[model samples]
Target: MFKENMHTKVGFEMNINKDDVTAPDVIALLQDHLKSMTLCSPPESIHALNTDRLRQPDVTLWSAREDGVLLGCGALKELNSRHGELKSMKTSPQHVRKGVAKRILHHIIEEAKRRGYQRLSLETGSVEAFLPARLLYEKAGFQYCEPFGDYNEDPNSLFMTLNMR
Candidate 1:
Protein backbone atom coordinates (compact mmCIF):
# COMPACT_ATOMS: atom_id res chain seq x y z
CA MET A 1 0.00 0.00 0.00
CA PHE A 2 1.17 3.53 -0.65
CA LYS A 3 1.36 5.58 2.53
CA GLU A 4 1.22 9.35 2.26
CA ASN A 5 2.10 12.28 4.51
CA MET A 6 1.35 15.88 3.67
CA HIS A 7 4.01 18.43 4.58
CA THR A 8 2.31 21.39 6.18
CA LYS A 9 4.94 23.95 5.22
CA VAL A 10 5.25 22.83 1.63
CA GLY A 11 1.56 22.03 1.15
CA PHE A 12 2.42 19.08 -1.07
CA GLU A 13 1.20 15.51 -1.02
CA MET A 14 4.10 13.19 -0.24
CA ASN A 15 3.68 9.46 -0.61
CA ILE A 16 5.99 6.67 0.45
CA ASN A 17 5.40 3.49 -1.49
CA LYS A 18 7.17 0.19 -1.91
CA ASP A 19 8.66 0.27 -5.39
CA ASP A 20 10.17 -2.18 -7.84
CA VAL A 21 13.25 0.02 -8.33
CA THR A 22 12.92 -0.23 -12.13
CA ALA A 23 10.88 2.87 -12.74
CA PRO A 24 12.74 5.56 -14.66
CA ASP A 25 12.57 8.12 -11.89
CA VAL A 26 13.82 5.62 -9.33
CA ILE A 27 16.69 4.60 -11.57
CA ALA A 28 17.70 8.20 -12.09
CA LEU A 29 17.83 8.84 -8.36
CA LEU A 30 19.85 5.66 -7.78
CA GLN A 31 22.23 6.72 -10.51
CA ASP A 32 22.62 10.10 -8.92
CA HIS A 33 23.47 8.47 -5.61
CA LEU A 34 26.05 6.24 -7.29
CA LYS A 35 27.64 9.15 -9.08
CA SER A 36 27.80 11.17 -5.86
CA MET A 37 29.37 8.26 -3.99
CA THR A 38 32.00 7.72 -6.66
CA LEU A 39 32.96 11.37 -6.48
CA CYS A 40 33.40 11.19 -2.73
CA SER A 41 35.19 7.85 -2.42
CA PRO A 42 37.40 5.53 -4.42
CA PRO A 43 35.96 2.47 -6.16
CA GLU A 44 37.29 0.13 -3.51
CA SER A 45 35.91 2.14 -0.62
CA ILE A 46 32.46 2.65 -2.10
CA HIS A 47 30.02 -0.01 -0.86
CA ALA A 48 26.71 1.16 -2.32
CA LEU A 49 25.03 -1.78 -3.98
CA ASN A 50 23.88 -1.74 -7.57
CA THR A 51 20.30 -2.19 -8.74
CA ASP A 52 20.65 -5.92 -9.24
CA ARG A 53 21.88 -6.41 -5.71
CA LEU A 54 19.10 -4.29 -4.31
CA ARG A 55 16.55 -6.47 -6.09
CA GLN A 56 17.49 -9.48 -4.05
CA PRO A 57 14.85 -11.18 -1.90
CA ASP A 58 16.09 -9.72 1.36
CA VAL A 59 15.78 -6.10 0.39
CA THR A 60 12.64 -3.98 0.41
CA LEU A 61 12.90 -0.67 -1.42
CA TRP A 62 10.71 2.39 -1.11
CA SER A 63 10.36 5.58 -3.09
CA ALA A 64 8.97 8.88 -1.86
CA ARG A 65 7.04 10.98 -4.28
CA GLU A 66 5.70 14.49 -3.88
CA ASP A 67 2.72 15.32 -6.07
CA GLY A 68 3.77 12.53 -8.42
CA VAL A 69 7.40 13.72 -8.54
CA LEU A 70 10.13 11.52 -7.20
CA LEU A 71 11.74 13.03 -4.11
CA GLY A 72 13.91 10.21 -2.70
CA CYS A 73 14.31 6.48 -2.08
CA GLY A 74 15.74 4.04 0.44
CA ALA A 75 15.94 0.30 1.17
CA LEU A 76 15.99 -2.03 4.10
CA LYS A 77 17.96 -5.27 3.80
CA GLU A 78 17.19 -8.02 6.20
CA LEU A 79 20.47 -9.04 7.80
CA ASN A 80 18.93 -11.66 10.07
CA SER A 81 15.74 -12.51 11.84
CA ARG A 82 16.25 -9.71 14.30
CA HIS A 83 18.44 -7.29 12.38
CA GLY A 84 18.20 -5.15 9.29
CA GLU A 85 20.57 -2.86 7.40
CA LEU A 86 19.43 0.36 5.79
CA LYS A 87 20.72 0.89 2.28
CA SER A 88 20.66 3.22 -0.67
CA MET A 89 19.12 6.28 1.00
CA LYS A 90 19.12 9.16 -1.46
CA THR A 91 17.14 12.40 -1.67
CA SER A 92 16.83 14.28 -4.91
CA PRO A 93 18.92 17.44 -5.13
CA GLN A 94 15.89 19.69 -5.17
CA HIS A 95 14.36 17.92 -2.20
CA VAL A 96 17.38 18.11 0.08
CA ARG A 97 16.78 19.88 3.43
CA LYS A 98 13.05 19.61 2.76
CA GLY A 99 12.37 16.58 5.01
CA VAL A 100 12.22 13.93 2.29
CA ALA A 101 15.06 11.89 3.74
CA LYS A 102 13.59 12.03 7.20
CA ARG A 103 10.24 10.72 5.98
CA ILE A 104 11.79 7.90 3.99
CA LEU A 105 13.99 6.96 6.95
CA HIS A 106 11.05 6.96 9.32
CA HIS A 107 9.21 4.63 6.97
CA ILE A 108 12.15 2.25 6.78
CA ILE A 109 12.52 2.13 10.55
CA GLU A 110 8.84 1.44 11.03
CA GLU A 111 8.94 -1.33 8.45
CA ALA A 112 11.89 -2.91 10.24
CA LYS A 113 10.02 -2.87 13.51
CA ARG A 114 6.93 -4.32 11.89
CA ARG A 115 9.04 -7.17 10.59
CA GLY A 116 10.13 -7.95 14.15
CA TYR A 117 13.67 -6.72 13.80
CA GLN A 118 15.38 -5.85 17.05
CA ARG A 119 17.89 -3.51 15.45
CA LEU A 120 18.58 -1.53 12.33
CA SER A 121 21.99 -0.40 11.12
CA LEU A 122 23.73 1.29 8.22
CA GLU A 123 27.14 2.20 6.87
CA THR A 124 27.78 5.56 5.31
CA GLY A 125 30.77 7.54 4.13
CA SER A 126 33.06 9.44 6.43
CA VAL A 127 33.42 12.50 4.26
CA GLU A 128 32.29 16.09 4.36
CA ALA A 129 29.53 15.53 1.80
CA PHE A 130 28.02 12.94 4.12
CA LEU A 131 27.87 15.04 7.25
CA PRO A 132 24.22 15.90 6.77
CA ALA A 133 23.28 12.24 6.42
CA ARG A 134 25.21 11.39 9.58
CA LEU A 135 23.41 14.11 11.43
CA LEU A 136 20.07 12.89 10.15
CA TYR A 137 20.73 9.37 11.37
CA GLU A 138 21.92 10.68 14.71
CA LYS A 139 18.75 12.68 15.06
CA ALA A 140 16.71 9.56 14.34
CA GLY A 141 18.37 7.82 17.30
CA PHE A 142 20.99 5.84 15.44
CA GLN A 143 24.27 5.69 17.32
CA TYR A 144 27.79 4.75 16.28
CA CYS A 145 28.51 1.05 16.19
CA GLU A 146 31.16 -1.35 15.03
CA PRO A 147 31.04 -2.74 11.53
CA PHE A 148 27.95 -4.90 10.97
CA GLY A 149 27.04 -7.82 8.72
CA ASP A 150 29.77 -8.34 6.08
CA TYR A 151 31.33 -4.96 6.76
CA ASN A 152 34.85 -4.64 8.10
CA GLU A 153 36.80 -1.90 9.76
CA ASP A 154 37.34 0.87 7.26
CA PRO A 155 38.73 4.30 7.95
CA ASN A 156 36.50 5.77 5.27
CA SER A 157 33.26 4.33 6.61
CA LEU A 158 31.10 5.19 9.58
CA PHE A 159 28.76 2.52 10.92
CA MET A 160 25.68 3.34 12.93
CA THR A 161 22.89 1.32 14.49
CA LEU A 162 19.53 1.81 16.20
CA ASN A 163 18.10 -0.59 18.72
CA MET A 164 14.50 -1.27 17.85
CA ARG A 165 13.77 -3.53 20.77
Candidate 2:
Protein backbone atom coordinates (compact mmCIF):
# COMPACT_ATOMS: atom_id res chain seq x y z
CA MET A 1 0.00 0.00 0.00
CA PHE A 2 1.75 3.19 -1.24
CA LYS A 3 0.78 6.71 -0.34
CA GLU A 4 1.26 9.28 -3.05
CA ASN A 5 2.94 12.54 -1.93
CA MET A 6 3.64 10.98 1.45
CA HIS A 7 6.70 9.43 3.07
CA THR A 8 6.96 5.67 3.19
CA LYS A 9 7.09 4.24 6.67
CA VAL A 10 9.88 1.69 6.82
CA GLY A 11 8.72 -1.76 8.01
CA PHE A 12 5.19 -0.94 7.00
CA GLU A 13 3.50 -4.09 5.80
CA MET A 14 3.46 -4.41 2.02
CA ASN A 15 0.47 -6.51 1.08
CA ILE A 16 2.01 -8.75 -1.55
CA ASN A 17 -0.43 -11.41 -2.54
CA LYS A 18 -1.53 -13.52 -5.51
CA ASP A 19 -5.13 -12.43 -5.65
CA ASP A 20 -4.08 -8.81 -6.00
CA VAL A 21 -3.38 -9.53 -9.66
CA THR A 22 -6.75 -8.40 -10.87
CA ALA A 23 -7.29 -8.39 -14.63
CA PRO A 24 -7.82 -4.68 -14.90
CA ASP A 25 -4.81 -3.81 -12.76
CA VAL A 26 -2.53 -6.27 -14.55
CA ILE A 27 -3.67 -5.00 -17.93
CA ALA A 28 -3.00 -1.44 -16.86
CA LEU A 29 0.49 -2.31 -15.75
CA LEU A 30 1.16 -4.10 -19.06
CA GLN A 31 -0.07 -1.07 -20.94
CA ASP A 32 2.28 1.15 -18.95
CA HIS A 33 5.28 -1.07 -19.64
CA LEU A 34 4.39 -1.23 -23.29
CA LYS A 35 4.25 2.52 -23.52
CA SER A 36 7.64 2.79 -21.90
CA MET A 37 9.07 0.29 -24.40
CA THR A 38 7.53 2.05 -27.40
CA LEU A 39 9.48 5.24 -26.65
CA CYS A 40 12.66 3.36 -27.54
CA SER A 41 11.64 0.70 -30.06
CA PRO A 42 8.85 -0.34 -32.42
CA PRO A 43 5.34 -1.02 -31.19
CA GLU A 44 6.10 -4.71 -31.23
CA SER A 45 9.05 -4.17 -28.93
CA ILE A 46 6.51 -4.11 -26.12
CA HIS A 47 5.33 -7.65 -26.63
CA ALA A 48 3.47 -9.54 -23.95
CA LEU A 49 1.37 -12.59 -24.69
CA ASN A 50 -2.25 -11.88 -23.55
CA THR A 51 -3.34 -11.55 -19.94
CA ASP A 52 -5.39 -14.66 -20.50
CA ARG A 53 -2.17 -16.50 -21.16
CA LEU A 54 -0.84 -15.34 -17.82
CA ARG A 55 -3.87 -16.96 -16.25
CA GLN A 56 -2.16 -20.30 -16.70
CA PRO A 57 -1.93 -22.61 -13.74
CA ASP A 58 1.83 -22.23 -13.49
CA VAL A 59 1.97 -18.48 -13.59
CA THR A 60 2.25 -16.41 -10.41
CA LEU A 61 1.43 -12.73 -10.10
CA TRP A 62 2.85 -10.47 -7.39
CA SER A 63 1.97 -6.90 -6.61
CA ALA A 64 3.34 -4.35 -4.15
CA ARG A 65 1.33 -1.81 -2.24
CA GLU A 66 1.87 0.69 0.56
CA ASP A 67 -0.93 2.69 2.17
CA GLY A 68 -3.27 1.47 -0.60
CA VAL A 69 -1.50 2.88 -3.67
CA LEU A 70 0.13 0.56 -6.16
CA LEU A 71 3.91 0.85 -6.13
CA GLY A 72 4.99 -1.80 -8.66
CA CYS A 73 4.16 -5.26 -9.89
CA GLY A 74 5.71 -8.27 -11.67
CA ALA A 75 4.97 -11.88 -12.58
CA LEU A 76 6.92 -15.11 -12.57
CA LYS A 77 6.14 -17.80 -15.15
CA GLU A 78 7.41 -21.21 -14.24
CA LEU A 79 8.69 -22.94 -17.34
CA ASN A 80 10.08 -26.15 -16.05
CA SER A 81 11.46 -27.77 -12.97
CA ARG A 82 14.18 -25.15 -12.55
CA HIS A 83 13.46 -22.20 -14.79
CA GLY A 84 11.14 -19.21 -14.58
CA GLU A 85 10.56 -16.14 -16.68
CA LEU A 86 10.18 -12.59 -15.42
CA LYS A 87 7.14 -10.95 -16.97
CA SER A 88 5.21 -7.70 -16.79
CA MET A 89 7.55 -5.71 -14.56
CA LYS A 90 6.61 -2.11 -14.11
CA THR A 91 6.77 0.75 -11.59
CA SER A 92 4.28 3.57 -11.61
CA PRO A 93 5.73 6.72 -13.15
CA GLN A 94 5.20 8.53 -9.87
CA HIS A 95 7.13 5.83 -8.03
CA VAL A 96 10.08 5.48 -10.39
CA ARG A 97 13.54 5.96 -8.83
CA LYS A 98 11.97 5.44 -5.44
CA GLY A 99 13.07 1.82 -4.96
CA VAL A 100 9.65 0.53 -6.02
CA ALA A 101 11.09 -1.47 -8.90
CA LYS A 102 13.79 -2.89 -6.69
CA ARG A 103 11.23 -3.91 -4.11
CA ILE A 104 9.05 -5.64 -6.68
CA LEU A 105 12.01 -7.27 -8.34
CA HIS A 106 13.31 -8.57 -5.04
CA HIS A 107 9.86 -9.84 -4.16
CA ILE A 108 9.52 -11.69 -7.46
CA ILE A 109 13.03 -13.12 -7.16
CA GLU A 110 12.35 -14.36 -3.66
CA GLU A 111 9.07 -15.88 -4.82
CA ALA A 112 10.88 -17.72 -7.60
CA LYS A 113 13.46 -19.01 -5.14
CA ARG A 114 10.75 -20.08 -2.77
CA ARG A 115 9.13 -22.03 -5.60
CA GLY A 116 12.44 -23.88 -6.15
CA TYR A 117 13.32 -22.20 -9.39
CA GLN A 118 17.06 -22.24 -9.98
CA ARG A 119 17.13 -19.83 -12.91
CA LEU A 120 15.17 -16.75 -13.89
CA SER A 121 15.19 -15.03 -17.28
CA LEU A 122 13.71 -11.82 -18.63
CA GLU A 123 13.23 -10.02 -21.94
CA THR A 124 13.55 -6.27 -21.93
CA GLY A 125 14.65 -3.73 -24.53
CA SER A 126 17.86 -2.90 -26.39
CA VAL A 127 17.43 0.78 -26.99
CA GLU A 128 18.69 4.00 -25.45
CA ALA A 129 15.28 4.58 -23.88
CA PHE A 130 15.71 1.37 -21.89
CA LEU A 131 19.13 2.02 -20.40
CA PRO A 132 17.69 2.68 -16.98
CA ALA A 133 15.76 -0.59 -17.08
CA ARG A 134 18.84 -2.48 -18.18
CA LEU A 135 20.82 -0.85 -15.40
CA LEU A 136 18.16 -1.80 -12.89
CA TYR A 137 18.23 -5.42 -14.01
CA GLU A 138 22.03 -5.46 -13.87
CA LYS A 139 21.96 -3.95 -10.43
CA ALA A 140 19.63 -6.76 -9.45
CA GLY A 141 22.23 -9.30 -10.69
CA PHE A 142 20.77 -10.03 -14.14
CA GLN A 143 23.28 -10.61 -16.96
CA TYR A 144 22.73 -10.25 -20.67
CA CYS A 145 21.91 -13.36 -22.69
CA GLU A 146 20.11 -14.65 -25.76
CA PRO A 147 16.35 -14.57 -25.79
CA PHE A 148 14.57 -17.61 -24.39
CA GLY A 149 11.09 -19.13 -24.52
CA ASP A 150 9.09 -18.14 -27.60
CA TYR A 151 11.26 -15.08 -28.20
CA ASN A 152 13.49 -14.85 -31.27
CA GLU A 153 16.79 -13.11 -31.78
CA ASP A 154 16.29 -9.41 -32.31
CA PRO A 155 18.64 -6.50 -31.98
CA ASN A 156 15.66 -4.68 -30.57
CA SER A 157 15.32 -6.97 -27.56
CA LEU A 158 17.74 -7.48 -24.70
CA PHE A 159 17.54 -10.72 -22.79
CA MET A 160 18.95 -11.31 -19.32
CA THR A 161 19.02 -14.06 -16.73
CA LEU A 162 19.91 -14.60 -13.09
CA ASN A 163 21.00 -17.70 -11.25
CA MET A 164 18.74 -17.98 -8.25
CA ARG A 165 20.93 -20.64 -6.67
Candidate 3:
Protein backbone atom coordinates (compact mmCIF):
# COMPACT_ATOMS: atom_id res chain seq x y z
CA MET A 1 0.00 0.00 0.00
CA PHE A 2 1.19 3.55 -0.81
CA LYS A 3 0.90 6.26 1.83
CA GLU A 4 1.18 10.04 1.80
CA ASN A 5 1.22 12.06 4.99
CA MET A 6 -1.41 14.72 5.45
CA HIS A 7 -0.81 17.89 7.47
CA THR A 8 -2.53 16.61 10.59
CA LYS A 9 -4.71 13.77 9.41
CA VAL A 10 -2.90 10.50 8.93
CA GLY A 11 -3.39 9.73 5.29
CA PHE A 12 -4.57 6.27 4.36
CA GLU A 13 -2.15 4.06 2.50
CA MET A 14 -4.01 4.13 -0.80
CA ASN A 15 -2.17 2.78 -3.82
CA ILE A 16 -3.67 4.24 -6.95
CA ASN A 17 -2.98 1.85 -9.81
CA LYS A 18 -4.34 0.60 -13.11
CA ASP A 19 -5.02 -3.13 -12.74
CA ASP A 20 -6.78 -3.03 -9.35
CA VAL A 21 -10.06 -1.85 -10.82
CA THR A 22 -12.77 -3.60 -12.82
CA ALA A 23 -16.29 -2.86 -14.02
CA PRO A 24 -17.93 -4.50 -11.03
CA ASP A 25 -15.47 -2.87 -8.69
CA VAL A 26 -16.44 0.55 -9.95
CA ILE A 27 -20.15 -0.35 -9.97
CA ALA A 28 -20.10 -1.44 -6.37
CA LEU A 29 -18.38 1.70 -5.20
CA LEU A 30 -20.69 3.98 -7.10
CA GLN A 31 -23.90 2.15 -6.28
CA ASP A 32 -23.08 2.65 -2.64
CA HIS A 33 -22.04 6.30 -2.86
CA LEU A 34 -24.33 7.72 -5.51
CA LYS A 35 -27.48 5.87 -4.58
CA SER A 36 -28.89 8.92 -2.84
CA MET A 37 -26.41 11.50 -4.03
CA THR A 38 -27.96 14.58 -5.54
CA LEU A 39 -24.82 15.19 -7.58
CA CYS A 40 -24.54 11.84 -9.24
CA SER A 41 -28.05 10.59 -9.61
CA PRO A 42 -28.59 7.53 -11.81
CA PRO A 43 -25.04 6.32 -11.59
CA GLU A 44 -25.80 3.19 -13.64
CA SER A 45 -24.32 4.67 -16.79
CA ILE A 46 -21.02 5.13 -15.04
CA HIS A 47 -20.50 1.40 -15.44
CA ALA A 48 -19.79 2.01 -19.09
CA LEU A 49 -16.56 3.75 -18.19
CA ASN A 50 -14.96 0.43 -17.43
CA THR A 51 -15.67 -0.65 -20.96
CA ASP A 52 -12.96 -0.73 -23.60
CA ARG A 53 -13.98 2.64 -25.00
CA LEU A 54 -13.00 4.38 -21.77
CA ARG A 55 -10.36 1.95 -20.58
CA GLN A 56 -8.01 2.07 -23.53
CA PRO A 57 -4.33 2.80 -23.16
CA ASP A 58 -5.10 6.47 -23.56
CA VAL A 59 -6.98 6.30 -20.28
CA THR A 60 -5.23 6.03 -16.97
CA LEU A 61 -7.16 4.13 -14.29
CA TRP A 62 -6.49 4.65 -10.60
CA SER A 63 -7.80 3.37 -7.28
CA ALA A 64 -6.88 4.20 -3.69
CA ARG A 65 -6.38 1.32 -1.33
CA GLU A 66 -5.76 1.11 2.41
CA ASP A 67 -4.03 -1.98 3.71
CA GLY A 68 -5.16 -3.60 0.46
CA VAL A 69 -8.72 -2.45 1.07
CA LEU A 70 -10.14 -0.41 -1.78
CA LEU A 71 -11.24 3.03 -0.66
CA GLY A 72 -11.92 5.10 -3.77
CA CYS A 73 -11.03 5.54 -7.43
CA GLY A 74 -10.80 7.88 -10.42
CA ALA A 75 -9.53 8.04 -13.99
CA LEU A 76 -7.89 10.37 -16.51
CA LYS A 77 -8.61 10.05 -20.22
CA GLU A 78 -6.22 11.72 -22.61
CA LEU A 79 -8.25 13.51 -25.25
CA ASN A 80 -5.72 14.92 -27.67
CA SER A 81 -2.63 17.03 -27.82
CA ARG A 82 -2.29 18.96 -24.60
CA HIS A 83 -5.71 18.03 -23.21
CA GLY A 84 -7.14 15.42 -20.85
CA GLU A 85 -10.54 14.52 -19.44
CA LEU A 86 -11.51 13.57 -15.93
CA LYS A 87 -13.76 10.55 -15.53
CA SER A 88 -15.22 8.28 -12.84
CA MET A 89 -14.10 10.41 -9.91
CA LYS A 90 -15.72 8.78 -6.91
CA THR A 91 -14.88 8.38 -3.24
CA SER A 92 -16.28 5.76 -0.96
CA PRO A 93 -19.24 6.94 1.08
CA GLN A 94 -17.31 5.87 4.15
CA HIS A 95 -14.52 8.28 3.25
CA VAL A 96 -16.59 11.22 2.12
CA ARG A 97 -15.22 14.65 3.04
CA LYS A 98 -12.15 12.89 4.35
CA GLY A 99 -9.75 13.96 1.55
CA VAL A 100 -10.10 10.78 -0.50
CA ALA A 101 -11.30 12.42 -3.69
CA LYS A 102 -8.91 15.29 -3.21
CA ARG A 103 -5.99 12.95 -3.03
CA ILE A 104 -7.07 11.12 -6.16
CA LEU A 105 -7.79 14.37 -7.99
CA HIS A 106 -4.39 15.74 -7.15
CA HIS A 107 -2.76 12.52 -8.19
CA ILE A 108 -4.53 12.47 -11.57
CA ILE A 109 -3.86 16.17 -12.16
CA GLU A 110 -0.23 15.81 -11.30
CA GLU A 111 -0.01 12.85 -13.65
CA ALA A 112 -1.54 14.94 -16.39
CA LYS A 113 0.87 17.76 -15.76
CA ARG A 114 3.72 15.32 -15.72
CA ARG A 115 2.61 14.12 -19.11
CA GLY A 116 2.68 17.69 -20.43
CA TYR A 117 -1.07 18.08 -20.72
CA GLN A 118 -1.74 21.78 -21.13
CA ARG A 119 -5.33 21.53 -19.96
CA LEU A 120 -7.64 19.35 -17.90
CA SER A 121 -11.38 19.20 -18.30
CA LEU A 122 -14.17 17.48 -16.38
CA GLU A 123 -17.86 16.82 -16.72
CA THR A 124 -19.96 16.47 -13.60
CA GLY A 125 -23.64 16.53 -12.82
CA SER A 126 -25.40 19.83 -12.20
CA VAL A 127 -27.82 18.63 -9.58
CA GLU A 128 -27.64 19.60 -5.94
CA ALA A 129 -26.29 16.19 -4.96
CA PHE A 130 -23.08 16.97 -6.78
CA LEU A 131 -22.27 20.27 -5.04
CA PRO A 132 -19.35 18.94 -3.09
CA ALA A 133 -17.69 17.63 -6.24
CA ARG A 134 -18.26 20.94 -8.02
CA LEU A 135 -16.82 22.81 -5.09
CA LEU A 136 -13.83 20.53 -5.05
CA TYR A 137 -13.19 21.09 -8.73
CA GLU A 138 -13.69 24.84 -8.41
CA LYS A 139 -11.24 24.97 -5.54
CA ALA A 140 -8.79 23.09 -7.72
CA GLY A 141 -9.07 26.02 -10.19
CA PHE A 142 -11.62 24.50 -12.56
CA GLN A 143 -13.85 27.10 -14.15
CA TYR A 144 -17.17 26.82 -15.95
CA CYS A 145 -17.08 26.22 -19.68
CA GLU A 146 -18.81 24.57 -22.60
CA PRO A 147 -18.54 20.80 -22.78
CA PHE A 148 -15.23 19.42 -23.94
CA GLY A 149 -14.62 16.47 -26.27
CA ASP A 150 -17.95 15.14 -27.56
CA TYR A 151 -20.15 16.80 -25.02
CA ASN A 152 -22.42 19.62 -26.05
CA GLU A 153 -24.92 21.72 -24.08
CA ASP A 154 -26.46 19.70 -21.30
CA PRO A 155 -28.67 20.96 -18.50
CA ASN A 156 -27.98 17.89 -16.44
CA SER A 157 -24.23 18.26 -16.76
CA LEU A 158 -21.74 20.87 -15.60
CA PHE A 159 -18.51 21.19 -17.50
CA MET A 160 -15.32 22.85 -16.36
CA THR A 161 -11.72 23.15 -17.41
CA LEU A 162 -8.35 24.13 -16.00
CA ASN A 163 -5.36 25.35 -17.95
CA MET A 164 -2.14 23.70 -16.92
CA ARG A 165 -0.14 25.88 -19.27
Best by TM-score: 1
Q: Which ten residues in a row have the lowest lDDT in candidate 3?
A: 1-10
Ranked by TM-score, the better of candidates 2 and 3 is: 2
Q: Give the per-residue Cα lDDT of candidate 3 at 145.
A: 94
Give TM-scores for every candidate, taking all chains together and pairing residue i with residue i.
0.94, 0.82, 0.81
Q: Give model 1's clash tally.
A: 0
- lDDT digits (tens) for residues 1-165 of candidate 3: 223345315654566676434557665874554444433545532322644544577877788777776678888888996999988787877767667788888888889899899999998877887788899898888899997788877677788998898
What do the candidate models score in CA lDDT, each in turn? Answer: 0.90, 0.75, 0.74
- TM-score result, candidate 3: 0.81
Per-residue C-alpha lDDT of model 1 across residues 1-165, encoded as one tens digit per residue:
223354735576689999988998898889889999999998887988788888899999999987889999999999999999999999999988778888999899989989999999999999898999999899899999999999998888999999997
User: Candidate 2's residue-wise lDDT over 51-131, tens digit each?
Assistant: 676678878777777677777777888889899998887777776777777677777888888989899999887777778
C-alpha RMSD for every candidate: 3.2, 4.7, 4.4
Return the candidate ranking by lDDT, descending: 1, 2, 3
Which residue runs does candidate 3 get wrong by more than 4 Å?
Answer: 1-8, 23-27, 30-48
